[model samples]
Target: MDDLFDDILNLEEQYYKEGYDEGYKDGAEAGRIEGRSVGMKTGFEKFLEAGRLQGKAIVWQSRLPSQQESSTSAGNSQQETVQTVPSPTSQDGKDSEPRRLPPLSSNPRLEKNITMLYGILEPGTLSTKNDDESVNDFDSRLKGAQSRVKMIERAIGEGAGDKGSANRNRQQAQKNENIEDIGRIPQRTDVVMGTV
Candidate 1:
């Protein structure tokens, strides 16, 4: 009887361990799947939001030149208040000065951001994932988009600071070169002074 009871207890112990192991495996898989789904969803949302912000910044930057031109025009036409507002008969009808858009290459950073934005936000990009699209691919794209957008934002925030400084330095260097040229006598290549 003792031996039989021991056998029954051992069988119960073995079955319990097997059931626990199965349950643990199932739970772990489910958790992993859930985690990946959540991660993908969040990554997509971040990409979308970043794309929108970048698009807006590009649009705003494009409009800056036009706005500045219009303001300058307005200032110049301040004396002629009536004519300042463009007439319907004028060329380009609605406005005497036609609106201008910045070229795609106007700002390299902006262009990069816009390109990245479009690539990520285009139809079927996030809406429908490709069968071959792996989680790592999605994550990589998300990180790329985020970084590019940040770069663009940083550039916009810094304004034309670096560019302006570069321009100033270039002009100064040109001035120095001109001064050096002025101080030096022109060498006559056609005449050999020592021989002559």
Candidate 2:
């Protein structure tokens, strides 16, 4: 009689336990999938920005006159400057002369900043690990690279259109896009609907 009553009395508790276990398993699986998707998207965005910075650094380095060129120029101040346009071969093996940007004015400070920017963004040095330390380091380096880019842009008078505004417009536009992306994330309706 006691055994019969025990089963009858605990029916609600048993169902609760079973439901809890099932919900836990489902929640864990869903969380894993969502976490992975977000992680991949974030990692790709970070690396894309890093690659952009690296490319900028390479171009800036190329534009800055080399020490040899500077020395030669100093010695021959009267001669007209000659720009060597490299005939970069296309992927189809066609001879295509790439449009060359005029060299940046030779400034010691500008050259040092460019070199520093390249060093900070060196490809091999950045870690792709998702650990806390690596992520923090990557963020710091990225911020540093961005600040350096703004400084370089200011020095070279590239991105600043209006006086005293250095890339702020572009940065603000990017921030707005990111905010819109965040707003688009699907909210969990199952909990609200009492389905979980």
Candidate 3:
């Protein structure tokens, strides 16, 4: 019958469509794998760029003391002389030097090995030599750090409170279990359904 033949054609088309969809899904998954690899490469590139900048900044800082010393001897502005570092010239001639300022000495080790510690931390801001100019961005960052410390302290306090509450809850739950008559418990159901 013609009806039977149409049904067979319909079934064949359905199977073909299913196979197409499965192939599409497989291709999409393969595309996703390639996308993930590209994303990872991009992330790694960004990390490397940040690290390079940090290194440049550190190098700039290391050379600050000599500049400071020169300025002091010359009776010139101390901060001013330190600001005039030459262009960075790496071994590769790809200069990353004087352009970048050293990160500051926030480390505890500054008391121990002054030279070694100074080698690590450099003045990030060239303009931040005096308390006047240094007070701008440095002030904000210091405030931010202070706020972060407070937040951490608050979090620790909150965590302790939550632990105490959870212990109380657990004890209550255990008490309920102990007091309940488990052997002769009755089965009950509450149903609220409109559509049957």
Candidate 4:
């Protein structure tokens, strides 16, 4: 009895140890997945920011060539020349002049596009119309799919009902045959009562 008790305790301890190890392993894997997802989110945000900055830089740079030519036109009036200032560049290829760009947060159009894109990517988000006709088109397609499903279900239900009716008839016929074969049963009372 003493040895059996010790053996059971040892088995219980081993079971708990194995359970703990598995739980720890699962937890570590879950933690790693969560960490990677967060890292991807952070990286995406940085990429968007860098992309925005690069876009701004390129747009401003494009206007420079035209503005420089217009400023050096030398055909404008003296007052125009005085008003127009030539922006100077630093020795290191960086612009010394500062230009103000519209804030990314203030662009309503871009904000709306971003919101729509996010909605498209994430489920349960608010739906927006890409266009007047496209929205209706999607709704129409959805309705078509639903109608097809309903038709299929009705066909299936009818098929199953037919099978059930046939089975019930078969069973009833079998029961009647068995009763008829068992004896010279006098069913005249019920038969006559039904006829009357």
Candidate 5:
């Protein structure tokens, strides 16, 4: 009968449609999971770098001489300096000798650069949104902060002359290693396979 033959011929097409629909659904779900994981990893790496820069800025700011000291020194260059000896015991009876960091040399330009660096890296000013504008803003701020770090390092004499060249080489090598780490992420092969 005609009806029986027609049904048999349509059977293969029906199965093909069902298989295609299932494949599409599975692929969509898998893609969503993979995309979310990659996004989270990327966001974590970016924020970690920002936090590291923020910590550096805080340490640098603390090392700078206080404004009061700078102003008084500027007003009286010939005054005799008095040194206060630290007491061995505090009021709580604990050893009070705290390790002190050497103050950065009082240079106005250096101070301004340090301030700018801190301002750029202020956590409140950064946004975590993934929209195009926010992403571009975050990227630009990150680049600015990185350049500020290099400038600060140079200002602090870490990048001075022959010794500085060696330090710079070491830094470059470290940066290359970081790049290689990022590159180690597996690339998607779906497009190539689809084309084939």
Candidate 6:
């Protein structure tokens, strides 16, 4: 009986270690897969965001020529001022050029996108963050994106409603125009009654 008890105890210990090892391996594999999937998803989102920002930049670039022309016109006025009066001197006693205020940037969405793009493009910026921290960051970004999308949807809906009303108004105007044209036609006042 003593020998049997000792054998049972040894068997129990062996099985327990085997079970722990297997569980640990399985958990590690699952963790690795989860981490990889999350990383890929985050990377793809960043890629899309970068592309969006690039598109915005392109739009801004296309508007640059117009902006420059306006600025040139403004510059002519500035040149008149320069000729009449010297700009205020700084503490260093050098002739300081007049500061030209930048053009008013009206698009908040574009600004935000550019700011986010800068953050994304910063060098080695995300290397120190761990997986859990990254997951939290992703959650925050997703929430912000969702809100932006909702706002866009609302704007689109309102725009569609406005277009529908405009279409109806246009159709009504056309109908009125047709009626006016019919009323302007000449009526026959002299009908011949000699034919049977």
Best by TM-score: 2
- Per-candidate total of colliding backbone pairs: 0, 0, 8, 0, 0, 0
Candidate 3 lDDT (Cα, 0 to 1):
0.50
lDDT of 6 by residue, 74-128 (tens): 8788776553333565555465665543433445664455345434433354343
Model 5: which residue pairs collide?
none
Model 4 lDDT tens row, 1-196: 3576787769988999999999999999999999889967864664454344334334433334344446446435444435333345456545434343322333344333333333333323313444667555544543443343334324334322456777988898887686557677566554655454
Cα RMSD of predicted structure 3: 21.0
Per-residue alpha-carbon lDDT of candidate 1 for residues 1-196, written as tens digits (9 for 90 to 100): 3676787779988999999999999999999999899968976776677567556555755555444567667767774553444555676655665444443335655665656655754545553453455545656666676666667656566433456767988898887686568678777789867785
Model 3, 1-196: lDDT tens per residue? 3576787769988999999999999999999999889867864664454344345334433435554455357645444545444454455545533453343334333222334323322345323343555545544544443343334324334322456777988898886685456465666456556744
Candidate closer to the true structure by TM-score (higher is better), 3 or 4? 3
Give model 3's clash tally: 8
For each candidate, what is the lDDT?
0.64, 0.84, 0.50, 0.49, 0.80, 0.57
The worst-scoring run of ten residues by lDDT in candidate 5 lies at 78-87
Scanning candidate 2 in windows of ten residues, the lowest lDDT window is 78-87
lDDT for model 2: 0.84
Candidate 4 residue 30 Cα shift, in angstroms, is: 1.9
Instruction: In model 5, state the lDDT of residue 150.
Output: 85
RMSD of 1: 20.4
Which sections of candidate 5 miss by over 4 Å? 1-3, 7-13, 67-96, 159-196
**Cα RMSD (angstroms) for every candidate in the order listed:** 20.4, 12.0, 21.0, 28.6, 13.0, 21.1
> Candidate 4: lDDT over CA atoms?
0.49
- Most lDDT-accurate candidate: 2
Q: Write the per-residue lDDT of candidate 2 for residues 1-196, one digit (tens) a residue.
A: 3576888899999999999999999999999999999999999999999999989999888788784466456747844554434565555545544355678998999999999999999999999898999999999999999999989988998864355464676677777686568668677755766555
Candidate 5: tens digits of C-alpha lDDT, residues 59-172: 888788875466456647744454334655556535544445678888888888889988987889999898999989998998998888888887887533348678888998
Q: Is candidate 4 or candidate 5 better by lDDT?
A: 5
Superposed model 3: Cα runs more than 4 Å off: 66-196
